[model samples]
Target: MTAVPTISSPAHLSSPDGKTAMTHTPLRIGLIGAGGISHSHLRHLLTLGADVYVYSEAGAAELVALYGGTVVDSLDELLAAVDFVDVATPTFTHHALVKRALEAGKHVISEKPLARTDAEVDELAGLADELGLMLFPAHVVRFFPEYVLLKEAVASGRLGDLAVLRFSRSGAFPTRTPWFADRALSGGIIMDQMIHDIDIARWVAGPVERVSAVSSHAGDATTPVEAAHVLLTHSSGAISHIAGIWGPSHLPFTTEYSVTGTEGSLAHSSVAERNYISHLASTDAPSGLLPEVDPAENPYFAELREFTDAFGGGAAPRVSAAEGAEAVRLANAALLSLETGQPVDIESPSAQATGK
Candidate 1:
């Protein structure tokens, strides 16, 4: 059986007096970037009954037409009008856009990686702190019910002392956008794709002391890399093997995780025909990040709702801006390990790394 803890939001809302209120007030949400990921967020925001405002260089009008939202003419207009901004733009643009939104006194929910570099993340974090605003990285996997259950189980000691864990995430290599291949922009596979598992690893296995990685990528930052594997040595002595791949266009997206402890184990696979509840078991499944989610149970929806409540002066969300910085730091550490061919020590570091 799973330990089902209720971490969902309360009925709290933002009051005109600038305090938490139980009465729901209309929240004006500004969505920047009309990419595919933005579509997911827009749908969820609508489901949450938010008044949506969208802005983008391209596709904003089209997206608003297909979905429901009023397209804004400029980023400044969107910033000025909304309570918060959801940044679903390309990897390289997150920091600047998030900073601009924060400076505008709007809270932020940024897509993953948060930013490309540690310095960028630090600047955003500091700005948010100075402004006394919240910046959440939409690490949606944390909102996935399966993952939430696993995390609760771990915390409950149902599986006893965690001994080892394995996580795998894969998806079709994002070729629609050239930025996905540019290591400087996307941080290659580690920061863009693998960072999902990296964040989860830290969440479940606790803080990491060090990291080592190997990649199939050869040549420079712009070179297209297909796959990479990372090893995380957690502070509590548990080890995790995380694999990320950008496979063929025909490759089905999949994700699976196995957590083992002294007393028992639990596992789940997206491609499974059927899954048991008791122990870790599977019968040959296709796996990676962004698994098939029922429309009603979309993790993206759950994630955004939580952030939306927090934006409404509710409780803080699960993934904080500092933790977002840490994810970038750890991903950079793995990238550094690839560069130097040695394990990178994070125990005594200032989030500096030699790679993207």
Candidate 2:
């Protein structure tokens, strides 16, 4: 077992205004797997002033040349060189890479759907806890300004109690990689694409009690157009209808959501003239809302900033390993429900351990 290093607070200088200054040494980060998504990670990591090292099995040299990182030949070499590891690998590689990094006592920020199965997620979470390391899953949607505002509105009692939540995320099929089409590897549209809305539903509506789903990719595996309608029954008695669509290859990316509560409702539509809108029972008409942000800002940068801040301060990450695991569990349940045409019950980690 690798000896876990104690995380000391980063050095900071105090300004005359009593605000802390950015005097801390930049975090040395290792990025694994350079693919389409890795560019986003690299851009964000660079913006944060981190010393980045990259390793990819297929194109380490090319990625390093393009992204300006020291090329390492293997995962072990990269792990040995950095304090934190940002995993931008494919869905199938997440479990093993995370496990190795955690065991090596390195803090990790992995892309969403932390693992394919609930059990795998549990094991990794347990290991990280035992080792006193941080494992943050990159659920970037949570960091989106509109989503953040929506969550705040629901949590502030402004919306009273949530009743029904509807979400739709549609895009052209991601045929960039061959593994994306493989259900066994990527978990198809539900696990790969819809997990974002699934996590959002869990964040706003509380734990999901049961899930029932209908999918278009029932029998024919080669279908180019894949769609799933998932119904989630939350423990708080709130219900959610999540629709995921991978239209044709030429379709544009779009997302829309509506959260209805006893008091009011908040909604967003990519196709609408105004993207975000909210209605409160206390008010008469719907109000158009737009988050004040730089047009060039990327939510992925915000997500990485959160991880680095938490890691430096030795505090808990916003999205814990356990939460990431549950997201995967929920996605799996939805897929299972889709296949069996029956409602799938979601068991908590404790319930599973107790065999309840």
Best by lDDT: 1
Question: What is the Cα root-mean-square deviation between model 1 and the actual structure?
Answer: 6.8
Global lDDT for candidate 1? 0.81
Per-model root-mean-square deviation over C-alphas: 6.8, 9.0
Residue 313 miss distance in model 2 (angstroms): 1.1
Q: How many pairs of residues in model 1 come into backbone collision?
A: 5
lDDT of 2 by residue, 91-141 (tens): 988999999999888999999879877778888889999999899999888
Give TM-scores for every candidate, taking all chains together and pairing residue i with residue i.
0.85, 0.85
- For candidate 2, which ten residues in a row score worst on lDDT? 280-289
Model 2: per-residue Cα lDDT at residue 46: 74
lDDT of each: 0.81, 0.79
Instruction: Assess candidate 2 and give its TM-score to the true structure.
Output: 0.85
